[model samples]
Target: MERELKLTVATERWNSAEEWKELKGYAKTFMLLMLLSMTFVILIGIGSYMRHEISAKQTTYGLATVDIKQSALQGMLAEELPYYASNQKLDTFSLSSLGLWLLEKVTNVSLLDPASLVASEMLYSSVEEQSTLIHGGEGSDPAIAPQDDKNMSLAPIDDEYLDELLAEVGNDNSSEPDEVPVAPEQEEEPAQPQGVESAAKPVAFIYHTHNRESWNSETSNDDAQSTKNNITLVGQRLAEELEKHGLGAMVSDTDYPTAVPDYEWEYSYKYSRKTVKEAIASNDELQYVFDLHRDSQARKYTTAEINGESYAQVYFIIGQRNPNWKENEAFALKIHEKLEEQYPGLSRGIWGKNANSGNAEYNQTLSSQSVLIEVGGIDNTLEESYRTAKALADVIAQIHQSEG
Candidate 1:
């Protein structure tokens, strides 16, 4: 009986040991599954965070790229922005205004529509009129004779008229003595007077003359003087090139107010027109008038390069709001063509008549040959732009020669 009891206890102990082993194996399997689930959750969180970071970075990079590209393009083409921080005009006339206008007009995105913005501004400001004059005035022909013959016969003769007539006849006779009936003098036609080639009149420059003190005031004199010095240097170079090509050219400042920093955007048109009209009145020989200026985009200073040397790009701006826009565009095209030929890729491209919200007329209405040339942005050193100016003078000389 004792041996049987001992054997029974041993068998019970063996069964308990087998049950404990099975529980331990189940616990190990559960722990392994839990670790795998936690690892998967951790990996998912890390992946999601990386994806968000990448997306945010891409958005930031894209915006910066767009702004830089636009600015570089503007500099190359010579479009005007607002003046310095003191005189801000860009807010009133935004590029977005022009962009929205283009979005409304252009059906396809593929077309090169630089004037989309300008067209919108036109739609709002354009007015249709039957007369050519800006102000209403009676149109008449002074050259036409009156229908009444009686009125013509009733006119009285005056001593002043008779004296003028006799004087003119006497002068004519003296000048044509060889034609008188004295054997015709065998005058040899005076050798037909060899045709004389007149030297080309030098190209003239016009700038705002008023507010000279403000432009070169106590606070901003250095900045203003620097800009003027650069301009004078460029003018000198242009004059030299013109002389080299036998095109007589001169650069002078119009006695008008200099464009105030903040006033350039809104009041530029008025000031520009006043100056140009004055120029026309003073010198009818003024053929090409260039309003020189600098830009404000920061990136333009970095992107422009010429002959492996980084420099500021130049732009040609035109206004589509004026009646003389077609001629202005033609003049711009000529400048672009000439510049590109002389300095390949130096010019960005000719901007359309309407692009930005700033003044469209830009004093171009004063003359068909007038243009606004933006040398570089504020960030660019004055020296870099002067180099560009030298190249530009060469190009202008070539164009002048060709025209002659």
Candidate 2:
């Protein structure tokens, strides 16, 4: 009986020990899980604090003090975020742009649209002070205080002088001391004069999808948009100038904002596609299509000095969404090469755009010869743009004539 009692006691002891072991294991697991949860919460708090601090400082100091000197980063940002790239030299830095850039960097996602962001309005109240300079208002004082954009518009030039300037530009040998720098051969034989009649049916079409896009000097209100003095005028000028080169050209006047029943700016290319189709159907002779736009960059990047005159530079945009985009790029390269030879520093290299960046196709599939050209920036004046139009006409004419 004593032996039986001892065995029962031993069994009870073993059972107690086993229960203790299981309890210890549970404690260890709970401790590990609690530790992990605490670490995660701490990390999240730190990240939120850092983001808040950085944003606060950026708001107060305008990121200008950051002095981002990395060219590769700048180029990449410019390529990806068009607004941040374009407003590099603004008097007041844009807050939304800075936030978007940081967000994109941290998230590793592309942010291409800038129109949706609330941006600081850049003002050019001291344009008169800038006009006195030689480089078409580039290098203007950044110290000018930002003001409300009310009644800001391009100062009118003397009409007689403008006519004389156009005439000199058209003349083969007319003595203008600062004539457009041309290739050695072109200097001997100037471009065909500006009013030559072309009997062939209109083979080139020039149109503006963003017809209301206006320069700082072109608008008279808070927004840089206008009904009359806008990009359409540039398209019109290009068409008339192309006609002077014996290439019949037509310009579109379809104002999408009013013409479309429910117009959305994002669907601008859709409206323009309809216009291009109609033009093609009506005129089978159309061989080339040109879409003209003004860049949103600063004056320093968009203005070029040639022969003591400031000419608004050109940027060729080829739509990568088109299956035959390479063909259009090749055609653009031909024009770009001619511009480089004739008007050095006028072409700002060719860039390709896709849906992530913009309307990917840009209606380029319509024709291999189709191209989109950015003539200048917001700060460029009408006269500077006109000179660029004339130069483009000269180069395009030479190319067309050679092909024939």
Candidate 3:
């Protein structure tokens, strides 16, 4: 039979084709898997790059110069950009900064920063803060002055008015849900007790230069200014919280505009300076002095969420005009670092300003331990601000304990 059989070359190869078919299938599968893997890696890279770009744009650091012409560049550089380089440095120039500058000019919407845009002339103004922000929450301009200065009235806050406000703060507002508002999805949790009680003389003094600064939520007004509800209430809350931490804190509720004769908003520092001097003179034991203020920015720039609770964000301002501002900055840095550890994003960051822009000294020359604190903004709620006050007291107590 073998001798009689005749097979063509094609038939002979077909008899052993199983092996070749299997190899071809394997090769195709391997190539497909390789392509899929490469595709996955490319997608991941694109996503990562996009995330990093957005973060870089929003980041306060880096070599980004501000767009300062009628925009809030000066305010932002003064408020957020601590590591910003000199304007003369060509190497540090940022195209992003330039783009932001151009965008701000063309749109007038403050695409770059959300600071005090409405009141550039005043540095920080009550009326300017009430204006609607470009993005509903972001504007970096320092603040714009009202068109008619003659018609502007000083916030009608006096010592008598402050006393009335203080009297109400002690009363338990049972109708209010809580001192700290929670996120909608979060359930109300019992607040942890703050600090050990102690009978100690006051070492900290909390005062407000812009005592009439009020929150939109508290005042229910556009101006966010009132003789009834003001930043002095927040200072009072801080003093109470500090007391709970076993740190004696004295609060000043002096309405500067009313306290000083022929009061001018520009002379607010001068008025507050007298207050600080008198307090220091009265008590040499005072080591820490905090000038509490409300920022002119919108809610988004001044709010933070910790766990399920909402809190007003804080910023520490150092006056470069003071020869010893570095020492004060160091002290502020300690508190800031502690906050970053315990509660992240609670502090926006430390900012420095000299005489060229705003209140250059901010009374930092009075004491190396002195620092200006801007809590919340015109749009924050009293509950949010109180939460921040408690948070600040918690950290300050820790520092005090550590130092002691």
lDDT of each: 0.47, 0.65, 0.64
Off by over 4 Å in 2: 1-200
Q: Which candidate's TM-score is highest?
A: 3
Model 1 over residues 206-315: C-alpha lDDT tens digits?
45322221112112443343434444444445455556666555454432333334543234345455445544444446567776655443433223555677655666
Tell me the deviation in Å of residue 163 in model 2: 47
After the best TM-score superposition of candidate 3, give how far the Cα of residue 374 lies from its true spot, in angstroms: 0.5
lDDT of 3 by residue, 264-381 (tens): 7766776786677666655557789899888867777777888999888887777664556667788888888877888887887666554433555676666778998888777788
lDDT-sorted candidate list, best first: 2, 3, 1
Runs in model 1 deviating more than 4 A are 1-200, 208-237, 254-265, 299-303, 353-356
Which residues of candidate 3, in runs, are more than 4 Å off? 1-199
Ranking 2 against 3 by TM-score, winner = 3
* Residue 86 lDDT (model 2): 88
